[model samples]
Target chain A: MLHSFTIHRAAALLRAGEISATELTAAVLDRIYAVDNAVKAYLTLLPEVALAQAAAADAAIAAARAAGTLADLPILTGIPLAIKDVITVAGVRTTCGSKILESYIAPYQAAVVDRLAAAGAVILGKTNTDEFAMGSSTENSAYFTTHNPWNLDRVPGGSSGGSAAAVCADECLAALGSDTGGSVRQPAALCGVVGIKPTYGRVSRYGLVAYASSLDQIGPLAKDVTDAAILLGAVAGYDPRDSTSVDLPVPDYVGVRDQGAGDRGLHGLRIGVPREYFAPGMQAEVEGAVRAAVELMAELGAEVREVSLPHTDLALPVYYIIAPAEASANLARYDGIRYGLSAPADSLWEGYRRTRGQGFGAEVKRRIMLGTYALSAGYYDAYYLKAQQVRTLIKQDFELALQDVDVIACPTSPTTAFRIGEKVDDPLSMYLSDVFTLSLNLAGICGMSMPCGFDAAGLPIGLQLIAGAFAEATILRAAFAYEQATAWHKQKPAPG
Target chain B: MSLTIAEVEHIAELAKLGLTDAEKALYREQLSAILDYAATLQAVDTSAIPPTATGLPLRNVMREDAVRPSMPREDVLANAPDASEGYFRVRAVFESGD
Candidate 1:
């Protein structure tokens, strides 16, 4: 019964009294208990808290019924959600998949969490992430790696891998994820779910642990486009607490849920296919799947054309330099003195040294060092400053291209999820996997990934749709339309 | 393009992450490969272009200066590793000359 119900469907059932919020919450918890051991999606589970929230939601629904105030409301009233470990939930452990923060409980809820709670959404638990949201796969998590539900041996992308995998595995109805550099979309692509990375500042970041502060944006992961929309509507808005949050009006996300491909499906919608994105060495299956999606868009009435982002080649390099430089600065606040892990040592400096040395995972420490070097005195101008210049050109490239197109389409990842330990030894190869998706972060644009097709191994392939700044509606409309035309998103991985 | 052990140590120090010899060697190898791959950006030229730090067009957004109610001290220290009497406790910093 739980397997077939999405957030919208479950919410309707709960509102109609066909199923109580307690029953819905129990079903999701049962699914988590049954499958999470093999999938390893959740980092922490608070069943008592979840059930308590479910009870509260049930009472709220009952009171609203008595007052006749439940006529028209949000569609996610009683749905369950999994929060990425990077986002704070008051009283829950927000580890960021790092040992340094492993025991650190959040003192206050993130703005997103507060909004979701206000909308009557129940947070089941916190999901795993790369330590400080640093890696391309969940293997970087200090606690545990999230396996792809499709094939337990393969990685579910990172650093929001657990959020993606949890939704894919039906561990939660919808989950929140953050994208610094394709963390949300790439993981969604790998886990075979719909994930959206709202435009920079489109969603508030207050209470979200800082990681590459300028690039990180929190968004949603869900089983389908409508579910993603419902979740986004609840969390996307301005917050006075978050200085970077945009003050733009929140659109009616669910209002446009059924917007199918219009008469000019592909005809008037200029879709750009950057040659740089389809470079040599890209997996044949990935390229084929994305091209097939473009063709499907054309059949639906959209216009497709080859476009050039001449500076595309510089994106990954610039992203690595700038993201790490920011990370180094942002992560500096985590010393033994403040919170979480602390190691005993002879002196204060030694204690700070030993704590971080023992607390941070290898990949995280490596990145901090690299980022620090890039921003250091003698090398700052050459590395950090130069990277910033290239970041601008990357943005200019997008601005130039968007002038001629409505949205850009590409493969979410260069290839599908790789074996868990395949590139763990080679950081460059791992970073290159994000080549197609990083530019969106640097440009502060919104992008989403939906299951397009499956490779020969039955692994899911994701087609990425990127829109210009604050153009989420256009992207969501197109993705929702594409999803309506296809059944790829309906295919689920067989239980391990 | 490969980074040396000493360079890795220097970077680690700059980053404030204390690394042991074993970790430093490992990072030296890893960072070298990453830096080598990142060097691909050097081929692109941008002599006249200005660096962009953000994507939004709006800047210099300021709010009226006003004080607001703050969180309770207990709530603020609920997760601190070391706290006492509504204050964050930390090791005392010594004067550099001392």
Candidate 2:
């Protein structure tokens, strides 16, 4: 099926004139029509817009072919991908999985969207997310929960749940997702796809609906490491509009991975296995699978060593404090005075209260209250400031450890995908699911998750590879090496 | 530490959220649980550590101040709940008697 083809493979076919963008997009649209009801991955499917973009891509490709310059075209040319709802596409409804912006059309597109368009990529539609990207499970989404494609009863691991599920179910070849506390990597792991959470400031966040500014980053979810690398390169770069966007040349990610390394197999690579990441409560199967993957890497000539990131346990608490505090400040713009849902009241204060209370979901409200309490008068130093100081310790831990090892390898999530509504009521339990993935965000590093193995129940487990800031090429190369040696990435889920 | 119902109400007011009494109670319990878990951070010896507000080494990202075209006012207000004459409408901030 065209939808099953990876971005690189599809691009090669398109360049060879064996297929057209229109055929690829229609196949994906047909797949979405066949399975979206059960998967609930997309909040809005832009069939018309996708077809139009596909037509345009075909024209560009045809022109390039006639001019004998087909080889110079972008790698993402004519590739169809899904976008997480948190990122906007101008003239499309971007709900961010919240009711407040249910019918709201984006006034401007995200920098990633513009870059993808420049690369001749097709945007299938906006996928679901945890409301305001707040929850670990997509159950927190106001509209509907996205099911894990591997097993229908399990969550697709959120807040990028929909994007991950879309990729796994073959609804889209690849997808764009935002990660703030493991939203992208965790979901990608649970759904058995490759996902990258780029280093902070690596990708411009100009049009992403803010959840936690300091931690938020746009990334890619795809069928394999190569596709993830391609998608990441297409969207990554400095943008003047986002002040936090770093001014640096994006590395040739695919080239770095394929430069005689596919067969070299991680020779001379230093892989760190942080002892803390394998702490208690991690599923036995998960720990075994990850350890086996590490052993395999060691066999492949990687210098595997046990590294210590002592402040790892504190990442969850620090993330909760920092993320929500920033979220409260960022979400303040949703007052009734501006766009989004407006609730009727006699006075502006009442209007603000009603609008937010009615618009935000339970998890969103809980975080807002937590954030308000943390940043409130007489408590800022104890909560927010304390978290920041601890954050320094956490960041230093990675810096100190990475000096000895080139990349850190661990389980992407504590376990595989959990059953839906499993941890929904207990917010703390839900928060714990992200423990393994949150530290990278706190340290502002890069991480990618790819399938390591499957459990006895046939669920997928993800092996997370992490690197220091702007060291995406390191993780990509390591992941690519691991991927080339294993057949885990080839497995497909039969979504119920 | 556990939060009182009154404290939760106060926080809701501060956050400009009109929560029902049930929501306030539920949130009070959940928030207390979260805060209690977060209390573990106090055990870390961070007294000598400087706070890091952002992980990146970015500061004062100033750009050239020059005239540039902005988004059209119509597009800007296109999603507004209520707009007239290119301005957003909102509830009155004060009572007439005030």
Candidate 3:
């Protein structure tokens, strides 16, 4: 139960001297030891490092209490959190779930990691991910596929699969995941936890290894909306280290909702129901769960209306084209000459060829090739350029719809978590899985996924909430309201 | 635009990746399928739309040109596959048409 405590609850106990950071961290480490064998959520577990941090947090908390500075204690003090392997943690191995960086230790911490450390959070370790954050399932990881906690046979949706699974299984209190093309939201949905992908520049991308630089945003995966909000607040800010990070102010997100309204949750909040998201071919049970959530929003004193993101159908192709094109360039840094796996050959060209050829996995190669082909001569205008134009239309579609609504509601994924290798071979089919969530990234807006219901198989289905750029407070408030009104977030997976 | 084995191989070479024969065949199949599916973009008339490199509006992100501390040489070379004299060492490329 110590591992299950939310940030706010844990903070109160730690402040009152009822529970120490070491005790909570040990509980989480034990939980990971007990469950990670079946779940396979973590790529690395830093027991020694985590215990040292826990001890540091305890000392800091004690010093603050004794000095009458307890009021200024960091909210995340003593909380155990997981970092996705893609985010560098200085001396920790930042594998990004690829063989190329299997032995790669980052030279510096990410801006978010620095912020979290300043807040006194304990890092559990690196969680597994799709190689370079490219796949819908962790199956694409050169390391290992992270199994769903609900059912070991199924995958936790990815490339943030390990992060979501860790949060859901209580391997750690919460986790950070990069949301590029629904990586965070989809996995959080599958694992039955809350996940938030802040507005594109809301969180700095300083140390997240670039995979589609334009689309990637570091976000939080936690047991509930409040915890996600806490973790989000800890990292959401402008950093001079990242050029693209917004100069806009980061509000007190955890306290944002508490000021506005009374018990009539989401009153005067207009929730847009994007009709295209509930289009044909989607799973019946998934649509049913989302529809039920919409109806519940209506009952909770929200004005709900059907809206449209006309470019919804084009999101998949747009994402595939644009993401790969960017990834193609982003991943080019891994040559035998630099940090990471290097295969020496007779010449420089051969070294580049062999190192990349041997280091990258099949899906990574497929994407790289697809990206190269798209950006190649005689095809750049046809594929990559057109996808960019359509991307504008997609952003326009969201902007048009959002003008009339505070937040848009949709399903996180078209379906629940699938079997491990179900659609990996059919690349297009797998790409379509993120149809509902990809456009938000394309629009550079805020979105989150929280549990709405369970399928007949008892798999978790996610309800997605979308808001305009830097509107995390609105999304957080609306989500917290719905979360408070429902028992769905209370559901936990059976022991794996 | 179905990609042939030659096309796949060409792309692989351009990307500095050496694909095995079987991988080239598989990529020819998969990449072609993906490319063919991606051709749907041609149906949309995007003449009026400007391409978006990122969802962020175009702006020259400038910072004060101030010198700052950098990573230590040891830390910089920590993960290098081949390092000599505190620098990344690579194979010679004597006029191999980069």
Candidate 4:
């Protein structure tokens, strides 16, 4: 089916003139219509906008072909993709999965969105997210829960759950998701797709609607490593508008991948098995799948060594502190007077309180209150500053480990997707779901989650590969090597 | 590290969120548990360690001070809850007849 085509395959067909962008887009839209009611991946569908973009892409392709400059066009042209609702799209409703911005129309687009448009990528629509991208499960969305494409009863993992689910369901070729903590990778792990959280500052955060400025980063969730590499190559680079965006030249990920295709076997690749990542109480099947995948990497000519990040256990506390503290400051913009929901009250202060109180969901409010306490007077030094210091220790751990190994291989999540509502009421338990994936964001390094194997019930397990900052190419090559050696990447969820 | 209802309310007030009593009680319990879990950070001595606020070393990123096209005031104010002539209208900072 055209809906199942990867970005590379679809682009090849479009370049070959065997399929029009419009036809490919229509097939995806038709699939969305057929399965979205059961999956609920999207908060808003852009059928009209997508078709318009597809038509424009077709024109561009035709013109390029006529001029014999088809090779010069970006690979993203005419590739339909989904955007997490947290990203702003001009003239489109960007809800961020919150009632606060339920009716908010973005006045301007995000830097990443502009890049996608420049690449002639067709945006399918905005997918569901945790309110303000705060929770691990999409159940925290003000809208509705995004059911896992593999099993509707289980969650897709989250904050970026909907984006992951959409990709797994073949609703789109690939999708963009913002990761704060494990928002991107964990969901990708649970949903059985490839998701990468680029090193901090690898992608622009200009219009991401900040959840945690220091922790949040935009990355891709796709069917395979190559598609992820293509999408990452398109969106990654220095942006003048984002202050934290690194000024270094963006690596040509696809070009590098092609160049390394000759050495696809992981010959001499140093793979570090972080002993801390394989925590107790993790599902046995999940651990077995990941360990087996690591052994495969070793057998494929990679050197595997056990490593330790002694402070790894402290990452969760530090993340909860730093993220919510930043969120408390960032989300303060949603007063009654500004864009989004405003509940009128007799006094301005009352209005502010009421609007925020009513607009934010339970998880958001919990985090905000926790952050307020952490940053409030008398507690700032004890909570926030202490977390930052510990955060330094966490970052140094990665630096010291990467000094020896090229990449760290671990399980993306402790377990596969859990049943919806199983941990909704228990915030701490939900937070534990991200144990294996959180340190990458804390350390400001790149990491990816690709399917390694499935559990007894058929849910997918993800093998996480971590690399140093701006070393996305290394992880891509490693994941691609593993993917080529295994059939896991080709597995897809049945139609919802 | 159990939080009281009053502490929860105080934190909520500091955050500018007006919560119902039920919410306050609920958050009192949840926030307390999360904070209790976070108390583990205290065991790690950071006396000599400097705090890391950002992931990258770059700071104060300045773009060329070139004037570019800005969003139209109409468009900017279009999403405002209340607006007047070319401005976001808000309730008077001080009550009238004060």
Query: What tens digits encode model 2's per-residue C-alpha lDDT throughout A225-329?
Result: 999998999999999999999999999999976684646677878999999999999999999999999999998789999999999989999999999999999
Candidate DockQ values, in order, are 0.70, 0.88, 0.82, 0.87
Against the reference, the lDDT scores of all candidates come to 0.87, 0.93, 0.90, 0.93
Worst 10 residues of 2 chain B by lDDT: B86-95
lDDT tens digits, residues A100-159, model 3?
998888999999999999999999999999999988889999989999998889989999
- Docking category of candidate 2: high
- Which segments of candidate 1 are over 4 A away from where they belong? A259-267, B95-97
* lDDT tens digits, residue span A1-496, model 1: 6734799888777778889888889999999988999999999998999899889889988888888887655566778889999999988888999989978988788999999888888889999998888988899999888999999999999999999999999899999999999999999999999999999999999999999888999989999998998888889999988888899999988776444534524446788888889999888999999999988987877788888898888899999999988888888888877688878776677777888888888888878888988888887877888888899999988999999989899999999999999999888889988998899999999999999999999899999999898889888877876888899988988656
Per TM-score, what order, best first? 2, 4, 3, 1
User: Candidate 3: where are CA atoms >4 Å away?
Assistant: B95-98
In candidate 2, which residue ranges exceed 4 Å CA deviation?
A: none
CAPRI quality level assigned to candidate 4 from its DockQ score? high
Instruction: Assess the local accuracy of residue A8 in candidate 1 as a C-alpha lDDT between 0 and 100.
Output: 84
What is the Cα-based lDDT of residue A26 in candidate 1? 91
Query: Would you list the clashing residue pairs of candidate 1?
Result: A265-A301, A265-A302, A266-A301, A266-A302, A266-A303, A267-A301, A267-A302
TM-score of chain A of 1: 0.98
